[model samples]
Target: MNDVNVYTVTRLTRDIRLVLEDTFQAVWVEGEVSNFTVSSAGHTYFSLKDESSLLNCVMFRGNSGRVGFTVKDGMQVLCYGRVSVYDKRGQYQLYATKMEPRGKGALQLAFEQLKEKLYKEGLFDEANKKPLPFLPMHLGVITSATGAAVRDILKVARRRFTNIKISIYPVRVQGDEAKHEIARAIEELNEYNRHIAETGGEYPVDVIIVGRGGGSLEDLWPFNEEIVAREIYASEIPVVSAVGHEIDYTISDFVADLRAPTPSAAAELVIPLKHDLTVRINEYRDRLYLSIKTKTEMLEKAVKTSRDRYVLRAPMNVFLQMRQQVDDLLRTAVSGISHSLELKQRDLGTVTGKLQALSPLAVLERGYSITFKDGRIVRDAGLLEEGDILHSRLSLGRVTSRVEHVG
Candidate 1:
């Protein structure tokens, strides 16, 4: 053998570790944690193991605090970081950058992860959810237009409310295109809402049904997508999520305002049953008819009682009593007129006698004489001048004379 060179294992290991670290920037690993311990210097040390094998792991406080939940021993977790050697211990360990619980199936894991992100962003909050309209005149449906779900909803809605209008925006319900189409439909509906509100036009849709027919997890995977969930959450109109079977829940269902068990159930929920409504209307009509009949009967009875009253039924008796009262008043009025005439005659006789007593003729009969001048009675003797015309009057006649001498 040529000269054999002895080299320390540590030097070879160091070189190999540097090469691996440079080659692999970062990676993700999933396992249950063990021998988890934290130092006062804010460093964590743990062993990650599956049934087959185990690897040492380390997470610093800076990265650990970013995890929402507590990390404990035996807790299955997926950690993302790089593998590097600990120089002192001469062992390789994971330097964890992020960590989350593992062992949940792929769908469940994605659902949880998206849910946690949206919850942190306040997208899935109850306060953001809108109230469904009590009576929707027009329902906008975002699903495959030709699918069985559309037919079911239309059949149920039309059978329940014949006048209800349904506008279907057809879109792919699965595969890569489903999420984008669903999101676009939601945005279009919101835009329609704004347009109607601005133009003061009738709202084209009152509630929205965003769903598809039942299928397996992979078939209904679009509804579980984060984009579709966020779009449903951000919609202004109330969304009724009807995706997958009743037992299957997607992210859209969690964030929607209401979740329907199926497409038929969603239709039934959005409208009323015509037969039940007709029954209620008939009951109301019967009650109204009875109320009116009762009121009319009472009014007729009142009118009949008034017709049978003494004043209306005994007109002859009423007339006889009124005529007797009028005759009695006439007799009393005649007696009062005769008595007043007799008193007036006596007053006239007395007044005539008093008038005769105060007459000038009566004074003449007592021998009183009168003098006159110029066809007038002389009031003063001095008024009579010599050669003035004079007149005299007796009780029965008058005399005309000329004055010739003073008195």
Candidate 2:
């Protein structure tokens, strides 16, 4: 005789799940997200895979709803969860409690994801970008006051154009709050422009330069933020993005109306050299004078040539010819008027004969008298009543009578 013990498949799966849950109560796993989907119940399901292995994961609505951004397929992510086996399906999955992006920093991943999103939305289209002015009279700058970017920009601007007026809006260049400051600065500058336009104020800002000195990626992160990009895109004034060095590109550069290699480059591009502009203006003035002189000479030559012609040589002959033409036109006009009057007189005579044939005075002259009551002709003698007053209009005048008998 022998004693034997066996467990059902469900019991075995339950035991495995309990062991997994106990060992991996809270652990972090890194892999790329695949087959990501959200159910109608607000739960997320996906597979975490790397080159070596794959792990199925489920994030409930309570945790998934807290994720700051959308979960897309093929996104590398770090998952924090407990591992357990599903008894019904006989499979294991990571019951993820929280998840963050992997490979790239969370903020950076968010920036990249947002960049692709906005780019698809046509925010980075060349047609939507505004052109920079050739020479901006009033420039608004937004950056840190003590930074090298501002100093370089100011120095370059002063050197390039001595008369350029700059209004600097000092803000934090790098920090958690830097993006907010930059966004508000852009919005405020545009609003100030609108206010100036409404109030008819002088020296309104025409262009805006928003950036900071070169720094590390962390130092330049504010410009990569979505809020800063949105603000730069929404600025009514043209914006020149000069964040970091030429090699260092940010989201601001892609969304801005213009991108300068450096802060000094932005300044140099905004205005032309005073001496160069002066020379150009002088050259234009000289060309204008030459053109006018040549035209005037040609006109004078034409006038001289015309004076040598027969019409201008003897102006009295031209005057006599014009007078004869005018006399002919007047005679023609008088003849036309006389003919029109004769036709109108004949039509009037015909109309008068017709009118005389239908005149009420002609009927009265024929010995017929019109009797009226209340200014209406009395043709029906039966309609008349005794004692009613009647008016009999004869050929000479009207006679009033009172009807004494209806007969």
Candidate 3:
């Protein structure tokens, strides 16, 4: 007998159904939901259909409660579940673990999920946002090399501030490689800036603007990616997001230090207005000129008034006053000399009178006489020898005499 044994056709079908169910159980699909129906057992059945194909799907009560919005027919959605074959009817269908409205496409949905996750982690907090320099000498731009965004930004910035310096780090703005390219460009700019600071060179850039022009949600999806957001948040330089139009918002905008409605607007915000600055300079110049003129006029008036002062206005009167002072000084000197002479004359007369009072001629004139015995004047009359000769003296002459009596 042959070793091979044949099984019933029912068993073969059952085995095949088990494999099909396992395959469907792990797959995810996105499509519009149609013919959605609920069973009495609380199970949901819906057909997922794209424009060309359709797949049967099922959601139990547990997964249905977790859905964000109501599930309805003709609604586009994403269903995540596993393929399974119903053992009773041997039909394959999707066993959904989760379902969501298809408002955002797959890429955008991934972006939003990452953005929400990072935001919760505080990477997009305003507290961590860096302030851009008011007057930046250098600006870094991260965008596609050939994109219109770069051109628009350059045009606006050049017209606003001709002295601004720009460095371009060109990268893909869309497609599979865009996210990595943008992230790398931002990191490179930061690294370059750090190196410049370390090496004592000019700062690499004062601000950085990272974005591309407006596009469909899918085309602008890279700016909304998590990697780009993290790079923008981590950058040391101030970052300005200029992705899409005013109505369109991206993750980069939320994570950036500043958000501009358009690329041209971003340029305007970052660069100063040259014409306005010129007007201010002219105004200051005029003010300084006026101040100098006013001060000069005041000084000139002071100088003219000083030149026309009282002394200068009457030259002869000033001379007359000086001459009167000189005359007064001469009169004082003459009076002092005359007074000194009179005092000296009075002192001389008194000395002369004293000399006269003590003079012998004055005694003679006063009728005083002197007598001498033996050629000597006698001061006393008590002692006299007999037969002594006496002399008499007057103020004008002397006489000789002899003494005869003793007393």
* lDDT (Cα) of model 3: 0.85
TM-score of every model? 0.52, 0.60, 0.54
User: What are the Cα lDDT values of the candidates?
Assistant: 0.85, 0.91, 0.85
Using lDDT as the measure, which candidate wins?
2
Sort the predicted structures by lDDT, highest score first: 2, 3, 1
1-407, model 1: which lDDT tens digit per residue?
26877557889779868986997558899899899898998888898999999999889989875564556788888889989888778888889988878865545566667778778988778888888876788899999988899999998987899887889999999887888999999989989999999999895678999899988887788887877888888788899999867897888888899989888898988887878878999999999999999999999999999999998999899999999999999999999999999999999999989998998778877777577665577888787787787666677676667777766
Native-referenced Cα lDDT, model 2: 0.91
- The sequence of per-residue lDDT tens digits that candidate 2 reaches over residues 86-204 is 78899999999888887666666766788898999898999999988888899999999999999999899878898989999999989889999999999999999899999999888
For each candidate, C-alpha RMSD in Å? Answer: 14.4, 12.7, 18.9
| Model 3 lDDT per residue over 55-153, tens place | 888899877755534567887888898887676776767889888777755555566677778889998788998988878989999988898999999
Pairs that collide, model 1: none
In model 2, where is the ten-residue run with the lowest total lDDT? Answer: 102-111
Off by over 4 Å in 3: 1-77, 80-115, 123-125, 295-407
